[model samples]
Target: MTLDPRLNAFRPDLADRRLEGQVEARHFVDGRPERVTVSSAALRREPRPDAAQETEALFGEDVLVFETTEEGWSWVQLQADSYVGWIASAALGPRGDGPTHLIAVPRTLLFPGPDIKLPPLMGLPMGALVTVTGEAEDRNARYGLTTPTGAVVTQHLAPFGGAADNFVTVAEQFLGVPYLWGGKTTLGIDCSGLVQVALAMAGIAAPRDTDMQERALGTRLAGIEPLRRGDLVFWKGHVGIMLDGQILLHANAHHMMTAREPLSEAIARTAARGSAVTSIRRLG
Candidate 1:
């Protein structure tokens, strides 16, 4: 029997070398390496630790990979922000298809057109990951979101200049939500997902995780005050959205998911924890 050439690419040995780079989730679109899938695994140096965070450099800097396997495990790498560590194979996926946008609001949706019939999810907020599948036609841009899920989630956002505008609305909706670890839904979300989902709604695509988002956005503001409507506020290991000049909204684990506070307040909150604000980026 002959195997389809497309199926041939699914083989693990097809990956010729052990690798190192920021591991990103997969997006289901036709682009080269679409943003989707969670990086659930890692290939480590040695002596794997029982705890994930205590493992050191295991989570953030985006360096994770594994050889293909029909079974549930694979080798891993931990190289987020130059800190390297290893984690389990179960955490990662063969296809990098997670989500391009993180949900900022308690609930949001994607649709085949700008209409509200095909909503999914059981009530969520904060860090829900949404992959864009399609867009509204000129006649229907005002009513719904057409997504890859083949379900129309909501129809409130007007399909305006690309998808960036959609992000702004999504960001606005999540005025408050709690943050959580390894979380990407409204139930709990981190700073970056707040920015990610907002941008995604505007028809622009980005990563679910913050570090990956920072790299993709490019260029940081010299000061937070100069940021635009869709700008992003980033801190060491955290991120958020810049609203107006004085405020930003996000689902902070410490603050609890979905809350709009002064950017200074957020900075102070992180500072209280001894984590200083790293930088803020203008994604728009």
Candidate 2:
């Protein structure tokens, strides 16, 4: 008998006997592009705009290589915690603008009025898109931006709208738009960007990222027990307004971007995704 090769080890066993065959690495993983090794990996609790995970180390059995073919399938070879999945190439790429300017390590500066470096935007890359909370003249730095991560970095930041009642109404105007990543305008917007700009228009300063936005609004709530028009409805990495007792309006990536989904259905989806009921901050 010939010795088994990596390509032959993957062959399915015929009857009870094993016949080795090598399986392409990407075949088992979901949403993989050209074949590539797992340069690094992480576990995400949820597959969403705001995915959070405690992170775990990689193991040889838990890894997969990307395929060289087109129209490839993804999703397999998951880690032990079952938090890892094959994400599409699009989502895997650098977020917010191109990668050239993402600083990864920005110069240290004081923020929110203090000479400190602990909170510096040193982690962000240049051209990384971030929501500006406001800027100020620090005793030590040129500028600082209150980042979507909610960190007050440096003193200089681009202008960002604040959260207030009026901004909620302004966001409503964007109903029925399409969802586009890295978009911050009415032309097209993702769940978080839509909320950010809409709130900006109304002068409601909300965070640029979904996780930060959730923290920026409302009291902790459960389900849709107390719903009303203008109440902020939180979903998996998305936010919407309670147009009435039964409806929510905001840009969504699941389907039609700017559309309305009933509170019950929306809530059910959140449960199905296994996320918690974060809150429902009223805007109007």
Candidate 3:
């Protein structure tokens, strides 16, 4: 029997066949909200290690848990961007309450103690949601973050919901970060991930993939208009943020890193590959 595309196992439906007495209804348990527990968690298209990763969820972000699999994965939709996918069950935990800070720098080390000399507990990437329990000031450092498990430098953390700087400035910070298929952190990132993280830091909410972003962001520009900084350019399955009318900044496998290149060069190369620029959007 064929399953409805929208009702597939990944989307509301748990199995291909509806069992007896099962209403086949989608339900949300409001009492059991989940949040990403790791520094970065992978959201995959299927509930398996080998499944294609669709996006990454930053620490402390709320997730709508649709269902948990016996195989140790949870079908969830990320609350920040509403991207639905499967994530490892262990990467999530009870919902964290009131995250008041966001990682503002490209990356920051979380140390086991306030002293920088000690080993680091973890590293959080820019845009990761965090809550500061306390603060420390030492002669060695100006400010330190006192988190539940450890502390991080406060200079890298910023108050959430504050005014955002230019999106292009944020995107440039990842210029040399390696390209990862489904990454969203400074360690590595994908085309959509680069755009999403940069926009999020600019206090803008964006979808997780190229197509979803094309539909949800900015006014589409006609072919005759000039591209500008902060404008988004999209091809069939890839995307890039315009550094200016002349340069395209993107994390791509071709360069194996985030790079800025002439927009004309990108257009010619992509056209040769049959994925020419499909849309250009400018966001205020």
Candidate 4:
């Protein structure tokens, strides 16, 4: 069987030790584990800063480092979904204790202390993980102490294993977020990114790109009839969520933002662009 380079940690010169006998490489070694330390870091196709960004590694996500170059790039595979790419070495740190909670809202401020009045150190996006060590109450508001420093609003975090009741409802929160290629956060997001992030909040694991998602997610539907809420509609390189039988929601380049519209309208627009819906899928 052929292994996908994007999903497997392998290259012409080096490969993960785990794939020792499965692939050809000049050398194989065990990869070291690391954690993303920045709020987010771009995973690029090449080591250069100008290379195409394939995805973003959110804060506290785990990655297995296979190689680190003097130029400060590290070839790593994301533990969340196993996507492989080169990320900045500086963005990673020792993998400490496992995360205890995930940011549940679109975005939240990471304050230096429990008080909201203090300037925030940074903003953590939804799905960013953190190890909550304790809690504090100030001015009747609650905050969660995260690791070595910083505090985040307690209400914005959900326990690691907790899931939202409906993924569609979670997707609805980013109705107007700007469309961004290779983006995964609410500040900017793309079609698959929106789907992936929302489904994650609902405890669903999904791949990172449209084609990968089309092949890996849900059961493909045949007739496209009686479309209900939470159905996924796909085009050659695009995807949208069925808000119901009639409406579609997606972060689209056409709108340059997450938008909702009639499914029929989206169908017509896509058809006018010389493409047709490739598949419709329903999650069981």
In terms of lDDT, which candidate is strongest? 4
Among these predictions, the greatest TM-score belongs to 4
Candidate 4 per-residue lDDT over residues 1-284, each given as its tens digit: 99999999999899999999999999998989999998889999999999998899999999999999999999999999899999999999998889999999999989988999999888999999999999999886899998858899999999998999999999999999999888898878999999999999999999999999999999999863799999999999899999999999999999999999999999999999899999999987
Q: What's model 1's lDDT at 53?
A: 33
Query: Which ten-residue region of model 4 has the weakest summed lDDT?
Result: 216-225
Model 2 has a clash total of 40
Q: How displaced is residue 125 in candidate 2, in Å? A: 25
C-alpha RMSD of candidate 3? 4.0
The true-versus-predicted C-alpha distance at residue 167 of model 2, in Å, is: 3.1
After superposition, the stretches of candidate 3 with alpha carbons farther than 4 Å from their true spots are: 1-12, 15-31
> Weakest 10 consecutive residues, lDDT, candidate 3?
14-23
How well does candidate 1 match the true structure in TM-score terms? 0.50
Q: Evaluate residue 36 in candidate 3 and report its C-alpha lDDT on the 0 to 100 scale.
A: 84
Candidate 1 per-residue lDDT, tens place, 1-284, comes to 54322111122233212221222223211111111233122233332544333122111124334342454333333322222323454443333333444343345444434444545333323333444444454433342332333333334322223344356677666565556554444444456656655665565666545666777785777873566666677776777776677787676776677777788888887889888877777764
* Stretches of candidate 4 exceeding 4 Å from the true structure: none
Q: Whole-model Cα lDDT per candidate?
A: 0.47, 0.44, 0.81, 0.94
Give per-model TM-scores.
0.50, 0.40, 0.89, 0.97
How many Å off is the CA of 146 in candidate 1? 12
Candidate 1 local distance difference test against the native: 0.47
Clashes of 1: 64
Q: 1-284 in candidate 3: lDDT tens per residue? A: 64323223333444323222343534424324788878999888778899888788998899877678799998776778767678999999986567888889999987877788888878888987877888786777754555466777888888988646787899999999999998999888999999988988888888777887898899999878877888899998899999888999999988999999998998898889887888999886
lDDT of 2 at 241: 75
